[model samples]
Target: MLLSDQAGQTAATKIPRPATLRESVIEAIQELIVSGQLKPGQHLVESELAELLGVSRQPVREALQQLSGEGWVDLHPGQGAFVHVPTVEEADQLLAVRALLETESARLAALHAGEDGVRRLRALCARGIAAVESDDVEAAVATNSELHAVVTALSGNQVLAELASQVARRVRWYHTPVARRRGMDSWQEHTALIDAIEAGDEDRAAQIMREHTEHTRASYMEQRGSQPVEPAPKPVRRRRPRTSPTD
Candidate 1:
């Protein structure tokens, strides 16, 4: 009887874990992209990723599909998946859409966020600032993403929150490399935005949020080179005529 009870207890303790392989693959790939390891425009080979993660192709495929839906990866009809590299125009369009959604979310949050929501947002911002100060660009990006998510959630609109979250995830790709080079000042804009939110200044918060996202869009374009929407001009420098002393 004692032995059977002990066996039963051991069996109970050995309960099977939940299915997380697909989620793990998704997270690993996202980390690689955001940490600049995978890089923008890089191909995502399932075989290679499966080998690296010791996962089967099925889970990798599922994860890739999910990422593709999230706008993080581009799925080709027959060539397989590659990381999505937004053109300047695509970035501008995404930013414009996000600005409209997020500014309204911020406005709603300023009016509706409870004490707990405010605390969470402030904590996220603190973590983001710390990450920026320590030059941990990836962490800073993640924390900033979390801050926006919290604000959106506080709005209590499920549809808006879902849409904003998806848009923010895509925006994160552009900020990865840029954040490391830009450092804390890259996030300075958030300070005013958060301040306005905390003060319950809905209009100010909305305006600041819009401006912040627009600024990010502009910076991304500037970094890629001016006239980002247009094809780069061919290099043109006039050649100096040779000065020859003629008789």
Candidate 2:
């Protein structure tokens, strides 16, 4: 049955199944870390995290352990949990892999992207530019990820998309550091990339993606100090539990 609120419009159908508490906590903590609310090397305490997330300590503890396995958190024997501090070596290796994967994705996307796909790319690029102009680093970072995800999905190669997804969040983690510094130039490169894809210039699209990813890699390596970056002030976050349509 559909339900209506004060406006008297259709407000609901069958409500979606809720995420398990542990899953919700895991997603929340991962978001906090990725969005830099939880900084690298900062300690994570179960009770505090539970309070922050309005969940039980059990789920928070489970989330931390799960995150540690995913390399987003560190669980020391006696010192408790800390946000994982990725190293220069780790960044270089992961970003290199991402570059290789995305270059091919761009090439295939150019070869195969339909008119609708091109339109979608243009829309995402515009949003990304606006985010950069507004100096909303988090929004910019999220849009950047969405744009790339679309590129890969347009490739129409399930294997390639899966490969890209594996590294996507890690790539976002690395991109967060360089988003503001890359600024308009990065989005301009994306504009060129979208144009190439729309024109079905596979080689040009591939080359643009390769160079763009490399520029991001160089910016990251150049901007990073000998330690984890000091995160900017945490932006206010409002989030809902994640759901998979297939679930």
Candidate 3:
């Protein structure tokens, strides 16, 4: 069956270069979690995930391991992986830390924000207000995160910005459920914070930011308390089919 072709030609050689399958699966699963398609504490069946992601079980397994290490998924001894259910304590601690970091960020931003920085903050605030007005909670929440991130960036402290970025995604996950409840008030607070920053009122900016984050934390806690936790199912072990010895 030899032909006029290289003997070592391979499937890998024929494929175009792009992200690895494992990385792609990881991002897909994260998106599922972030978008709330995969609820917290929901069971993750490898076969189901493989079918949904159009991938084989092997890459899904590897991605789950990576996600488990990253705190997004919990790997059980025999039950397999489930979405990590955030505890109230974990949310409170993270939000408290965010408040500390962001209040400092607001003060630094007031100290360093130039005309362009102020203008950018105002623009994000405008977008956030518009989203809220239109009742687009998701867009409003996203814009809210962007506005906070810009304030962090305007702080001009690389270390502070890095820390804020690390906690930002998880913050968004918790914030999404409560966005509508906080809607107009959240944007109103943003407007006031922008005003403080624009006026170079460092103390006022810090105070407003602290209050804003605290309000969000309270709203999230209230909403989390209202929702019921889904119970984890007992694992079912598969039984081998019995076969009789034949002579």
Best by lDDT: 3
* Alpha-carbon runs more than 4 Å astray in model 1: 1-24, 61-71, 74-81, 226-247
Candidates ranked, most accurate by TM-score first? 2, 3, 1
Model 3 error, position 15 (Å) = 23
Model 2 weakest 10-residue run by lDDT: 226-235
lDDT agreement of model 3 with the native: 0.91
TM-scores vs. true structure, each candidate: 0.73, 0.84, 0.83
Specify the highest-TM-score model's number.
Answer: 2
Residue-level lDDT of model 2, residues 96-172, one tens digit each, is 99999999999999989999999999999999999998999999999999999999999999999999999998898
If ranked by lDDT, best first, what sequence of candidates would result?
3, 2, 1
Give stretches of model 3 more than 4 Å off: 1-20, 234-247
lDDT of 3 at 62: 99
- lDDT at position 71, candidate 3: 86
Cα-based lDDT at residue 230, candidate 3? 64
lDDT of 3 by residue, 1-247 (tens): 4543545574334566799999999989987887678989999999999999998999999999999999899887778899998889989999999999999999999999999999999899999989989998778978888999999999999999999999998898888888999979998999999999999999999999999999999999998889855645656888899999999
Q: lDDT at 140 for candidate 1?
A: 85
